[model samples]
Target: MSPRRRRTEEFTSYYGRPILKEPTWEALDIAGYIFAGGLAGASSILAAGAQHTGRPRLERAAKLTAITAISASVAALVHDLGRPERFLNMLRVAKPTSPMSVGSWILSVYGPLAGASAAADVLGIFPRAGKAAGIGAGIAGSAVATYTAVLVSDTAVPTWHDAHAVMPFVFAGSAAASAGGIGAALSPLAEAGPARRMAIGGAAVETAMSFAMERSGRLSAETFHQGRAGTLLRLSKALTVGGAVGIALGGRSSRAVSAVGGLAVAAGSALLRFGIFEAGRASTLDPKYVVVPQRERLAARQEEPAKADTMG
Candidate 1:
């Protein structure tokens, strides 16, 4: 060889410019929308279970929480879109390939059911109809909880796209944590058994999944541990774990402690969403996040042919 080839120490775009455009979505609106949607979806499932178990206080609280969270979620989405009717316009057609379309449909269907169930529960009218609506809402709510993960992961954002495998599980766990949190906070200690258990289980899952995602060695995974994203994620994990512990220890003894723990869990869930959003955006801003992965792939492809030649 005339000269030994040296691997580049770092990859960069021309003039050190970013290769990918950052997402235009506002962090507050989108992150809040995600948090609320997850809270609503998971709360509906809890509501259905509470209904079946004859925990009327838990059931009614969960139902009300579901409707209110979903309403806030939809309002945030509409506000971001800058038009309320734009949401309705999406219902005109169904597109299976589009996460936005599917999510819109899910929201449309779940919203009415949640609203009807909550309204009937509060008004003490149409008990049978309300039960039916609650069941229907619970079914739709499962999709509502996890679809946002798919929606974000489907985008070109490196951090989000790379975490696609774990994102849904993360979202699902977070949703359950938030729902259980609210229920435990609002319901009496005797009726709050299920909520406390749910919060603990959800917290465990959320923590484990997030840790796995971060350690999976994806290039963009670094974004999660750097800067604002890092701060938020770390705090979220602490609060979630601490909250779960508090719920486990104090739920049976003290109402104030249980409520505080529940609030902490809910706050942690919200921060997790915001942290993930910030991580994705941060990845887009850095040229290395885009360039390095592409270079690694190109190197791998080049090595594949050489390996084949050696075998020959």
Candidate 2:
């Protein structure tokens, strides 16, 4: 009998180099920007809601969170750009077609509004102006929370680009969860109701979207399931779920529990952003994550034409 032959698939590149260049973004800076931006944006929204509902403490905490987080987010972005002027240059042109341009504009508008709102809350001056600014910040914050998703997905990274459909939803959920966490942690027990609800709801949405994105079974999705990215994502999910549960159970009663749970949720949100950033970078390291998907698409297109010819 002839010896049996086994065939294995291997992905290689010219000189074993990656097909795509890895992103030059610093992990800490960019990932921190993503986390802080989401947190700030959602906190602005929560602040408006709290103000409308007459929750004074919650409103103040949320406002403070919005301004602080956004400030940190801007700092991270500027640091990553290597020059503060680079950020300002992005604002000179408003290109609706470019996520970066739109995002730059959003940050510029949202920052002042958030600062005014926070200043009003802290300094107890210009209450009327602050309220109006808070509302404006809320409106802009909506975009700030999810715009990063669009910004990153607009890139050539396989994992991020491929997951575009669900990326915004994931970011929105993460933002809400983190904002809720901060609110709950800072607010008194009597005023923690809304924060707890937000935390639970956000966690649910984030968890569902994360699962859906990963379960798509695409080759790139594998980056999210292996290595450091995988570990970080897994931990993020656990902390988010645990934090949500803790808030649900003890948030209404124990101040200590609520604070711990809220912090956990925020930590999880940060880790989720980091994990996603890592996954996108990891996707660029291996040629298979890029080449295989393109080859598959090409094969499918060729098959479609052959089928059409046969039908004709």
TM match of model 1 to true structure: 0.96
For each candidate in the order shown, give its overall lDDT on alpha carbons: 0.92, 0.92
Name the regions of candidate 1 deviating beyond 4 angstroms.
Answer: 1-9
lDDT of 1 by residue, 1-312 (tens): 211112223455688778899888898889999999999999999999999999999999999999999999999999999999998899999999999999999999999999999999999999999999999999999999999999999998999999999999999999999999999999999898898888988999999999998887887998899999999999999999999999998877888988999989989999999999999999998887766778779989999999999999
Candidate 2 residue lDDT tens string, 115-210: 999999899999999999999999999999999999999998999999999999999999999999999999999987998899889988999999
Q: What are the runs in model 2 whose C-alpha is more than 4 Å off?
A: 1-9
Question: For candidate 1, what's the RMSD?
Answer: 3.1
